[model samples]
Target: MPRQRKRACQDTPEPETEAPAGKLVKANKAEIPAEPLGEAKTSDSPEKNRATKESGNETSRYWLMKSEPESRLEKGIDVKFGIEDLKAQPRQTACWDGVRNYQARNFLRTMKLGEKAFFYHSNCKEPGIAGLVKIVKEAYPDHTQFEKDSPHYDPSSKKDNPKWSMENLILS
Candidate 1:
């Protein structure tokens, strides 16, 4: 008996007659409608729009911050104890930086001049609220991002148009 070779039609499965591209395919769930790219759809309801506007205008009435006592002690030693010692430390005057969360970013955006925040020390043996900080200036471009040697440098950020920033805060 001679060996036989299969024809292309015999080897391959026949292609099904199906709907063309862009046509809806039958599925278990209904297809989700996609919004146009780069543009957010606004609510048609007037009440929803009014509520959104009001919420955007609302100031962050309060906030809390944290620092470590051991880190503070490592930085410097002081004869005075308690809140006074913490207040006297140089780190107390340091700016709050490196916050990357979108919600935190939004809060930072909402922060206005003179807004007060409670400084709290965490991840330490004695974790608790430490002191008060006043927002001395509104949000501005963070200089750290521009430094090539800095850990915070972002290549995406430019000197003219910065994405990340810091706010001037003073101890009170």
Candidate 2:
């Protein structure tokens, strides 16, 4: 079997519970098909694993992104850009942004266009895999990190070469 990459994220913070309403949406998938249940076959055979590993031209990639239902500031408001929030969007589309951590920011840089990411809810009563979102847009500088009024703003981050990046993840 192939070895998985050791990411910087240690605590997933996902609690087992009900799923989110964000699943009932759609997105473009000309190459890969959507699975509403978020279930897929995991090959254990050496031959099958070797075959997948040999497919160097494969463009699709999978990911799991964790988000909190309510942020520290929005705790009492019962509002944070969770799965529900993404579903509430005009077209059920949103971007995974405002990542202040350096390590997480680096992970975002690795995201490629059309990559599939599982939207997992964290810091909530029912924290678990909620739905799926596709990386419609690739990594780019996060504009919020430049705004002085925004909590994600970084004074040290230069405009030419920003310290953070973000990607558009729409419901799939």
Candidate 3:
């Protein structure tokens, strides 16, 4: 069993739970492929470990993003979103939103297009890296922060000067 943890959606906290043993489920009741359940494989080679893309003089960096696999409610909104949910999006693309931490938001702002990230399944029974996603778009204003019903919403955030940011990712 994996230890439970609190996920931060801005100031809201959602309890994480273990994912049930079965297929990955989408919001539309469709079944999507899930990562194999077991220990995650790793490589020690610097070449393989460093998944970077060179652009001009800058190199894209790697990142690990954690999401809950099971359903969890926060502020009347279900904050349960994971790799499977992402894979179900149109063209396998979705906004990496709901992050409110200032530091984490800053990190999101720094992400470059074409960068790859490990989609880690957090707060689940078999928590581990589920798959990889590519940064298809750079940081932008997170629309979830503007929705009053969203768990990530912030009443104080202004449209002219958004306090939160998000990135667009596609399954890789």
Candidate 4:
């Protein structure tokens, strides 16, 4: 199993469907219907659209991954994937997985292969863009959500219908 992560908010409305395997999805919607669970689903446009995957050569995209320096920096108690730790990984790569937020999970699901993101260190003594990381692997079910002992564990999540996903990142 993979690392655990916090599950999505129960109030957040679910996506219409999961993105297909080996495909790309663009979150073109102005906003997604997520607030409280009781509210009715709303859309800015009359027509409905689905997340589409790219079939051919696609352009690379950019992203910014923020983290608190103390959480991931070397010798930190939390020891989540930090800048220096990623450098020591085999091939200087590590799994960019274990995110618990629903919205963040959606972004990872729709991400394209080879996309590059700026690793920004947040809430630290010196907070700024630390380095770069490339998406080496596509999103897949994060198995950690089910681990009872893990901080990210979610008993409500199931294997067949995983509530979380993850990807592998290589330092660039």
The backbone clash count of each candidate, in order, is 3, 1, 1, 2
TM-score of each: 0.50, 0.67, 0.68, 0.62
- Tell me the deviation in Å of residue 152 in model 3: 1.2
lDDT of 2 by residue, 25-95 (tens): 33332232223223233468654442222355443557767677665552122225677677766455666
lDDT of each: 0.46, 0.60, 0.65, 0.56
lDDT of 3 by residue, 1-172 (tens): 2322222222221213322322342232233233222222234775444333343344556676768889777765567778767665555666778898887787788777777676778777767667777777788888888888677789999999999998777777
Query: Any runs in candidate 2 off by more than 4 Å, and if so which?
Result: 1-45, 50-56, 74-79
Number of the predicted model whose TM-score against the real structure is largest: 3
Q: Which candidate is the best by lDDT?
A: 3
Off by over 4 Å in 3: 1-56
Model 1 off-target regions past 4 Å?
1-60, 68-93
Better model by lDDT: candidate 1 vs candidate 4? 4
| lDDT score, candidate 3, position 38 | 23
Candidate 1: residue 117 Cα off by (Å): 0.5
Which lDDT value does model 1 have at 104? Answer: 62
TM-score, cand. 4 vs. native:
0.62
Worst 10 residues of 4 by lDDT: 32-41
Worst 10 residues of 2 by lDDT: 4-13
